[model samples]
Target: MANVIDTLFSASISRHVICVFLFISLVYTQNTVVFQPPFVTATGPTVTAFLLGNTSDVSLSLRTVSPSNTTGSIGSPSCTDEATRWVLTKEQIGKTAVRIKLRLNQSLHFCGENETSTNCCTKLLCVLEALQVTACVGNTPKASLLVQATINARLFPASAGNDNKTVIPNQVYQPLGPCPCDLTVRVCDIRCCCDKDCASEDLKLFASHCLPGPFGGQVSPDPDYQCSVQTSKNSPDWFPFLCVTSPPENNPYLGLFYHGSTITPKSGPSFQRQIVSAPLPVNMYVQGSPIITLNNQYFSIPQRVLGRCVNGAPVAFLENFQVECVTLLRSCPTGSPLQTLPADLSLKVMSGQGGNVVVHVTDKVVTDLNSFISKNNALSSAAQKLLCENVTLALDYKFFWQGNGITAVTLTRTIGTLISNVSVSLTTRYSAVFLNGNITAEPNSGNPGYQVGKPVIAGTMDNESESIQRAFISIWNPVGDGLCSTAEKKVVLFGKNSTSGCLLPVGQQTPPQCNLLRETVTNLQASLITSTYVAKRGNPDLLNLTDWMNISFVTLNSSTAMEDTASTCSGIPSHQHILVWSLVTGLVEGVPQREIRDLQIRYTLSTWAQDCGGGNSLCEDIQLFPITSSVTFIDIPVITEPPKARFQINFTEYDCNRNDVCWPELAFPITRYYTGEPYSQSLAKGMILVFCFITASILGTPWRQIRQVWHSIAL
Candidate 1:
């Protein structure tokens, strides 16, 4: 029994030793465990609290005067002690509440005992205590005071669904009642409004102030008050007070300084007051008187005679008049009162030769008279005698007397015979005369005194002339008369024999011979004279002889007889030789001298005669004569160049008086610019090249690129 007991004791001892070794090993390799109180309570007039250990196993301790006293409740002191206590544990981590009731003027402290007083002395104070329960695995432990409370209560570890028994969480606290307070005052820059008592109540905030010259003269704060200084007269400066004045009214007659004053004109006469003289009359012609008249048998006088004052006397003047015979005769009758009287006439008075006096007259019958008379008188006297003896006499006398002045005695002729089956003709020629003078004559009358028809013979007979015998033969027996009786004695024998039984001695001739001789004597008159008788039984007067009619018998017989024979000849005998002679004179007056100047006058004469050239023949001839006259008045001198002195002008020295010589010149400024080469060649060529290049690039490169891309995409 003693041995078994010894064995048991030995085994117990061994176990105890093992146990101690294991305890040492565990202590060497594992974390140490510190023992702390499970619960802590605090109650004191002033209290402080502390937490120890890590979050994994936290320790709570109370610092109070009587923390071990149980009789003191957590926040109040009991009758036996001045302190109270409570516990902090794992379950209380989030479910715990801390309350601190601080008295006025009392102080409480946290973390260490009485290290510093809390601000709760002026109010309630509270705090949250956190205990970090971290694992003892190579790390330091952290504990915190997370939440605090005063009259306001707070909880720690907050209310949450999941928790690690570690860190203390944040909490929210609310005041149980009105929180205790302390008051403070501060100053701020603002405007305040005043109350009725003038005390400020509301505030007005102001914008921030900007300093001057802040932007280095680039920007300005106030632009309205800016000013600039002017440098010269042309500067762009504004002055508000100045303005231009209005111009005064203009008047040319008044001086510039004499406004509103009456101006006196320089002395001169008005046009109405000037004196003017009348023009004097000019005398062109001197005055004189001259006589004028119109003869009764020739011209008709004007009914109202016009007169002009010449030498202080009114003188009757004649102008244009007409001359016509009362009887329808071409020539005035023999012994007619106006046959030798003046016809149309006019005259005027003149102080000098240059004065004008004109007379106009018409001589209707006088035209071609001189030419006719000249031709008729040219016929042989022997031809006249033959006609008288061969044929019974028949006389036709018609005459017109026309002249500007008195008509002088002119010749007349009577036709005593006409031969049957024979023709006689005469022709006249004309000449031109131009004269300048006035015509005067008597007034016209209806009856010019003369007998109508009667005849008387003049001049002595001559029996020896051969012309007389021819005249007798032609007058009584143009175609051969009855034969002479044998009892008749021939006073003149006209045969080729000198003596024959046909002749009878003188005085031995019987009554038949005397009768034959008387007949021969009657026919042998030298001049066959005719006269005008006023009545059937009135004594006849021979027509006044004029020098225009004188002619030799032989000459007359040779020319006249041949002419007569030739005129009456027929067939081949009509071509017998003939002779003619003529004399003529013409008078004219009152032709203007100027009209005759440089004048060409032409005269035309014509004749027609009948002849037998076996069957029938007519002869006609014309002659033209021209005369020219040039007149120049010696009274008026010729002037080749006229005077130009009236139009000549003279210039004086004062004509060009002027003070200023220069005047403003009109000018304009012209600006010139250089022109490039023609645009059509230079600019258009460059543009065309550029356009072609662009078009080619677009057409060729882009198209190729597009085609390549398209093909690749298709592949």
Candidate 2:
């Protein structure tokens, strides 16, 4: 009997402790409240609305319920406590923004009857308030404005320590705990979310900045959210982050326009506390299509806008530029002489850079924005007025700078379509190393950026001499490999070749992108490569000084087809004439700039036997033997000298900086190599190696160590 009484006392004590714990959570745990646009459907926006409630109290009984849009009517509001769900209705998302409030009630279970059940305001514990959002409401995108960019939680990656809690991932990310484990931030399928489809119709297209969002949002921990929920299981380093391959193109006819920041122009010229943001506060990200307006007409540059990281820095660029010419008709009146305007559009790459965004060219086309309107006058007047009434943006404009800076106002118009369409190819240098101290680290996995040369490229932002092989084109000329007269030339094949059927090499399997290019360059007989050249950070002293001057600029476009061809592979038959053509053409920069000369066929083989067909007709008896290599470029300014195998460009400091002192090929003494060498490569190499060793021994660079040093420095 005494033991039974003790047990009863213990049970009563446990019940009291439980009630106290629940009370503490109800009273002390703070609540976070916010509003979101309802998911609209064909019928209407779904009533399932969320009132995000985040607290450390961990009381599972709390829920947001009884949602009421004061000015509107909602289907009897209902909720599930576990998920903080509140059912709203289509009527609640009316034209006028509604003021909605949700009751955060903690289910009461009276341990004792007198525990304050007096105030029955549905026992109003707290409120989750929200304002109606108008955007992201329609089931179909009625406007041309599609998704510009969609970012995710990886921006604020979780850690073994305090897994992404404070900032980084925005507040909206925490609403639905569907994320598997905060390992990656899933980019919501905007197409499904906003009913916008920018791809070829009939083919349900879903795309994303994340490698697999279109496939289905990364697998959700919440079974309710169906999709391929990615986890660390796919790849240890795979972290779902924000990315966009090609954002939906805005109305091409509307022309490119900048929705400038909304600001009241120094109201009445009165003193006001400064509100400024620089280096953009957050890791700056701006994405737009390649359509530029000229003379109030939108001309779509036959190019796709894309973002890629080079050396861990983001670069916005355009590629495969297709040219289209059309006359934009002006309408002053019903038949006001059919005022037609001819215009051209071209691609421009703007890298998110620090320091200052300056352009060195004096003659570059400039569009001043000091007194400017947002959209083209060609757009409907009603839309124009609507945009104007939306924001009275303060106007600020200036000339392009001679260095990298995005702070000043830029009109960002388009280049006119010239008769030849030969005036365009721009380069933007991107390096995470430059942003080391200046910008916050924005993580990207698809393009982890080139993994080498950060230390070499860091401090020389202004000096063109400091630039190295940041771009690559894996090119090759096949002699009659009799691969059926087929040649493979691709920078990085994004599409398939109809004739060859093979997807052409993209080299997704190589490390050190330079080598990846070098190893994947399709060869005629044997793969070609350039000799490794050494470069010190900020100085170019190791290679032959003359080679540096005559071909140093060429080094900007340095490339190698097949290296040491004489020693490696046998040449193609004399009858099969070697041909040189461009696989990748630079806009504005013609053949003269990228391909200075045709790469010679250096064919050699190891079999040591010329087992050719008897008459050399069908060649059935002889087995075809050709080795493939990887080169990073097709045709570019190059010096095919044995000791100096590198791609080069004609762009001298003159072209880059517009200075009289730096003329193209001015520093380089052109060396002409005629047909037929007198000596064997072995002898030439032996003598050159000995002489280099002796000279370098005295000059701090041993000829034997040059290769080793460059191997390390390239990183």
For each candidate, the alpha-carbon lDDT, in order, equals 0.23, 0.25
Misplaced by over 4 Å in model 1 are: 1-322, 325-510, 513-524, 529-715
Q: After superposition, how far is residue 159 of candidate 2 from its true place, in Å?
A: 31
**What global local distance difference test value does model 1 have?**
0.23
lDDT tens digits by residue: candidate 2, 1-715: 3233223222321122112222333333443322222221111111222222222221112222222446333223222233433332222322222223222223322223455553222322222222222222123211110001111111222344542232223222221123211211121122222222221220122223222221222322322112233455653342344322231222121111222233454343335544422222222222222212222222221222222111211122111122222222222112211111122112132322322232221112222322222222343444321211111111111222111222222323221111111121222111111111111212111111111222111111213223333222233434333242355443322111111112222212112133333333323322212212212111222222311211111121123343322112222221111222222212110111121123222322222222334543433332333433322223333454756334335444545354556444332222112213433554565577789987868767565588788889998
Clashes of 1: 50
Residue 28 local lDDT, model 1: 29
Error of 1 at 228 (Å): 99
Compared with the true structure, model 2 gives a TM-score of 0.17
- C-alpha TM-scores of all predictions: 0.11, 0.17
Candidate maximizing lDDT: 2
Model 1: per-residue lDDT, tens digit, 1-715? 3233223222211112112212333432443432121122222332222222222343333223321245432233112212222222232222121222221233343223454534433222443221212222233322222111222222334355543222222111111111101000011111111111111211111111111121111122332222222234644445322322222211121111211223454555445443423322212211111222222011122122122111112221111122221222222234322222223123221211122222322222221122222212233444332121211111111111111111111112211222222223312111111111111211111011111121111122233221111111001111112222222222211111122111112221111233343333323221121111111011111222210122222211222322212223111110111111211111111111110011111111111123324443332222111111111111223356876564333432222233232121111011111124453555566678789999999889779999999999999
